[model samples]
Target: MDPRISKQRTALVLDQPFFGVLALRLKVVEDASCKTFWTDGESLGYNPAYLGGLNDLETRGVLAHEVLHVANGHCWRQGDRDPKLWNDACDYAINPIVLEAGMLLPKGVLVDTRFKGKSAEEIYGILAQEKRQKEKQQKQQGKGKQDGSKPDAQSWQQSASQPKQQPDSTPGGSSAPQSSNANGANTPSANPEPTATPDAAPSCGEVRQYTGDDKALKEADWKVAVLQAAKAAKMRGALPGALEAMATDAVEPVVDWRPILHRFAQESSPTDYSFAMPNRRYLHMGLYLPSLNEPAVGDAVFVRDSSGSVWDETQAQFAAEIIAVNAGVQPRRLIVMDCNTRVTQVQIFERGDAVELDLLPVRGGGGTSFVEPFERLEKEGIRPAFLVYLTDMDGPFPDEAPDYPVLWASTTPLKRARKAPFGEMVEVIC
Candidate 1:
């Protein structure tokens, strides 16, 4: 090594070879005429167009929002999933945290807008009305950059990306996560939002107990409302569901998924990642990435540990967002692998299309392992450029993971991956 060689000068270095599983190197374009923030696997496109440079807090929130996407498995989760749908899920999924952290939304998208009409900056009241009241009543309270933008003392703080310290759990709740999978099935729970706000009439601070007069949007109708909003955001492009996402609802984070590693010693986060109706799991589940890009279409097949229970709706949305991101990149090929076989793959799913990818492979499994995928890829002569092996920290990995990049997304902060050589690994709670 050159005596004076700097880490910045070195193209790549790793704690474990497999840890760096991402395919695109981010690009940074900063000057007078650039547009809004967008990413290709390799780089970023910046706009000097906005004259106001971010103040430290604003900058951190914006960065946190983007980083949260990568850390949350928002990118890879979209494998063969519909892009638009998945992105819509994320905007809704991360809304609480983003708003809590102070990311402001456009003027009218807030769900409570029809009522308040932007007169009050009521923090997270729209999302968790009771929570806001409780916190305000309590009078209690509550990182920065490196890379293309410029490195600073915050460079060291980037470690804050996934803080070693656990975050505060959901307000006014017990330690137990609301529900868990039973035999590879979806466990239904009332929506994470506490079943009170979906129909927040023009009242100040009332937690409703459905009256005979109760009239809420039908589930199908609510879905349509959400879609109409997401479509309005997506057609304008640039992060898809941003407007419909409603950044005003007190983005304060809820549960941080990082604790499941040790907190649920008897159980494990599911390796089978899927979308459920929103839950309190996201705040803790957040991850921070600098950026992401599209790999060549079919260049990689995202395999799921569908052996465990799954979040059906959330998983469906995960698939959709990936499509949204990829649609922007226009990958050369796209292949989705399930435990059983490939289905409805090779083509991108357009929004509103009734997509039914084969789900057989998602079933017929009890335990977990990485072997089936090695054999699958080998059968196709496809050596993945990198792999994101999401797991629950309970299963043992292959005696050897191929010499490629792999991030171990396990429940708790990762300890040691016994085997799986060469690839970079990250522990993500499923």
Candidate 2:
């Protein structure tokens, strides 16, 4: 390891342990051929001269920037996208985060305030759209020239004599010029301004594409590493605010809940074989095989929080998912309980009964208490296959875990879901 790099890694371990834990995982190699620094989710390669150019603070920022690319799984997440553009988007998304952690990036590093708090995929879409527009404008300009539409010699000379607007050399600086339409209304110019291109933009580090078949495995490993790093930082009381939310998100990623709900329903429903009911088809073949006894899909309990905190759209989505789950699982009984401080309303849908939200009554506009639904289930002797509680997770949880599986489909921010005493929690986006 280069002495400078080694020194910075130690500094990170002491100051920012979360990033330090991830940074130390990357095997460092001093390569003069590497223009700046780069990480391929495994190793960090840097030019010694480039490392020498940056001051201590800037060098630390560059190191952290490379670690963030790996930590964020940017290398593995670039699926079928333009590699250069994806890397640029990843930089834009990571730079502000690095800056927010109180580190100073080298001059001209990619930093767009618009991309702050956005995922790399989101940033990539914005960058890709801008690139397409720029290409379209260039093509139109080329076609106009071919059509013999040329500027007058005097106008051309005057335009040529005018000083060109220097591209904003500072990171995150806006260079776009505003123009007026026929109605004299000022609007953003259709002509793409000269901003940061891959060649023009000086990145702190590059996110190299992962070319392995085990992209998912690699991504999972990084997520685990991130969690472990977070734990270590928390132990030392050094985790940054930016990293806290990010770490929580890494653990509970935003995913479609339909498939998860289906899986839970399928897994919770019991299946057995009964020797008393011998297979008739096997009996004809002189084989005494036991008959498969699949019981009716058991009761599925859905507890809705009727407290004012839960959004109407969230409730609607919850109802829609419940209906979908019921259709798929075809449960013997679908019990819908609306509760706030106590059970406000209980609607039972027996097998073959239509499950519709529009017909269901919405009740309660009071304080939240999750204990009521569980208490009611125990009192009624209802051993459901699974119970899904749709809430903001703001209320008090049951004192003890229920016998059946519990899935908390919370509409609140992910950080709030951590408060659930017992259950698998998923963020339900409206």
Q: Per-residue lDDT tens digits of candidate 1, residues 1-430?
A: 1111112112111211111111112234454443333332223344443314434333333333333343333443344434433343344454444455335432222132122211111112123333434455455221112243344445557866754421112111111112223342223323434332433321111111112221222222323433443344344442223333432221212243334312321122122323333344454577332222322333434555443322333234335434443343333343444331111112223323455433232332343455666666667687644444443433444566575445444332333233344454444422
Local distance difference test, candidate 1:
0.34
Please, what are the lDDT tens digits per residue for candidate 2 over residues 67-139? 9998887887676778788889889878887888888899887776555576676566556656766787788
Lowest summed lDDT over 10 consecutive residues: which window, candidate 1? Answer: 15-24
Instruction: Indicate which candidate wins on TM-score.
Output: 2
How much does candidate 2 score in TM-score? Answer: 0.53
* RMSD to native, candidate 1: 26.6
lDDT for 416 in candidate 1 is 28
Question: lDDT for each of the candidates?
Answer: 0.34, 0.76
Query: How many clashes does the backbone of model 1 have?
Result: 57
CA deviation > 4 Å runs, candidate 2:
150-199, 253-430
